[model samples]
Target: MNSIRFTKWLFSTLLFISVAVSSCQKDDNVKSMDSNKSIAAADSASTMGVINTPGNFLAGKGTLKITIEDSTYTFDAATDSVAFINVHSGDSKYFGITAINKAHTMSFGISSVGFAATNVNSKVAGSQFLFKLDEKNPVVQYTLTKYGGKDDSGKISIEKYNNDNLIAKGTFFTFLAKDDKVNSPFYRVEGSFELQLK
Candidate 1:
């Protein structure tokens, strides 16, 4: 009888131990799941940083500040933006600034296949990345090449480009330009802006 009681007690103790262990394992799983959710929430909050917060740019020496409606084309225009790295329309890396009405499009580009982003120098006569401008009026195209006595020139700086935000800041000093349908002159196209990429 004593042996029987001992066996019964042992079985009860084992059952209790099993239940306690199972409960602990369940709690651990729940804690892990909660941690994962918190991490996901944090990641979502930092995506692309901010939007519509257009930065400020000061037109330097030779550039003219052209204003249209409410925004200035040279600075603080809602149309200014940065592009993804090597992820452009067909697989190109570019930075562009445009007029609010989408009438003017100025872009800088470099072929990323065998080029380093750090080597993009507009000041160099034969820069790896070239500057090109396209405007309405049946969309006249202008390049940074030299004209009568002026040449397009500038510099680009990537302040911070990451999962959080992208910033391609720079200054430009271009000149009187001529194309098939456009004859435009620039005193200097110098400005610097900081904002996230679209």
Candidate 2:
């Protein structure tokens, strides 16, 4: 009778210890999994925060503003018409941004070739900038051509590009000539634009 009692007690004690250990291990594993999931969530949130900033044009309507010499021209989605063009032809790609004021008399345009979505935050060379103060009058047109000498050339830098949303934001600076003469007067033009691709 004494030997049987001792054997039963030993078996019960061993079973209790085994069960306790197994439960502890399971708890540890669950804690580790939870920690990893939290870390991944934090990383994802930070990445999105960096990509989507405040006042992002891709989130809504677009805007365009340019300064020509002493005059500043502004176009907004609320009152003006802003548009973007993306074209692929052969081995090259073309990107353009155009804006017209509500009055329909003033317009601004910039065009570049060989720039793609991968060119974000990088300067795109050989861009042409055009500003027309009077659409019906040819004399009021100003243009910056790629062949217009070093001082007359310009660059366009795209700050953000969203291929999924078909939106882009960029800035440009150029020296536009009123005429093709070497001694002709030129206006310093600088501006920024945000538009959805059409």
Candidate 3:
């Protein structure tokens, strides 16, 4: 009878030990799941960074126009004909200006006119990607290459003053792009604009 009691007590102790170990395993699993959830939340929050808003600007469409003078023409070996030398100013309606990293990107079109030819109704769509502007002077340089010709580039210097009650503005610049067969037969163009933001 003493041996039988000892055996029963031993069996009971073993069952209690098993139950304790299982409980500890379940608690560890719960803690692991909670830790994983916290890590996921922290990663999601860190991925969203700060975003800055740009200031309001005017629509430059139909707000400015440019005209060229002293365009020259020549013959080309590629076309095998006297292809009239010309420059196409893109349509202003499709032009755009945007601010990027303290600088401005001025993308616009030029109307190309053939030298010594009747006025044509077609204008080429061209763009300049990067234009550097100083916050103080805000002078911008525009450059673009002829579709199948040489590189044409120029500069524009703009000055402005901002006050609480009044604002003063000034702009003056010239840009030229030309297609040359031998020495670059091209045209010179200029733009002028005056605006008052109230």
Which candidate gets the maximum TM-score versus the true structure? 2
Q: What is the Cα-based TM-score of model 1?
A: 0.32
**Angstrom error at residue 41, model 2:** 42
Residue 123 CA error for candidate 1 (Å)? 3.7
Ranking by TM-score: 2, 1, 3
Displacement of residue 94 (Cα, Å) in model 1 is 7.1
Residue-wise C-alpha lDDT for candidate 3, range 1-198, written one tens digit per residue? 653353234333322322222222222133444553344334432133101011212211113334445421111111110001122124212111211211112223222222211122223333222233345655343333342334334333224322232122222233433322344434455553222222
Q: Assess candidate 3 and give its TM-score to the true structure.
A: 0.27
Best by lDDT: 2
lDDT of 1 at 192: 45
Give the residue spans of candidate 2 off by over 4 A.
Answer: 1-60, 118-139, 145-148, 163-166, 196-198
lDDT of each: 0.30, 0.51, 0.27
Candidate 1 vs 3: which has more lDDT: 1
Model 1, runs deviating above 4 Å: 1-142, 148-152, 176-186
What's the CA error at residue 96 for candidate 3, in Å?
8.0
Candidate 1 worst ten-residue window by lDDT: 55-64
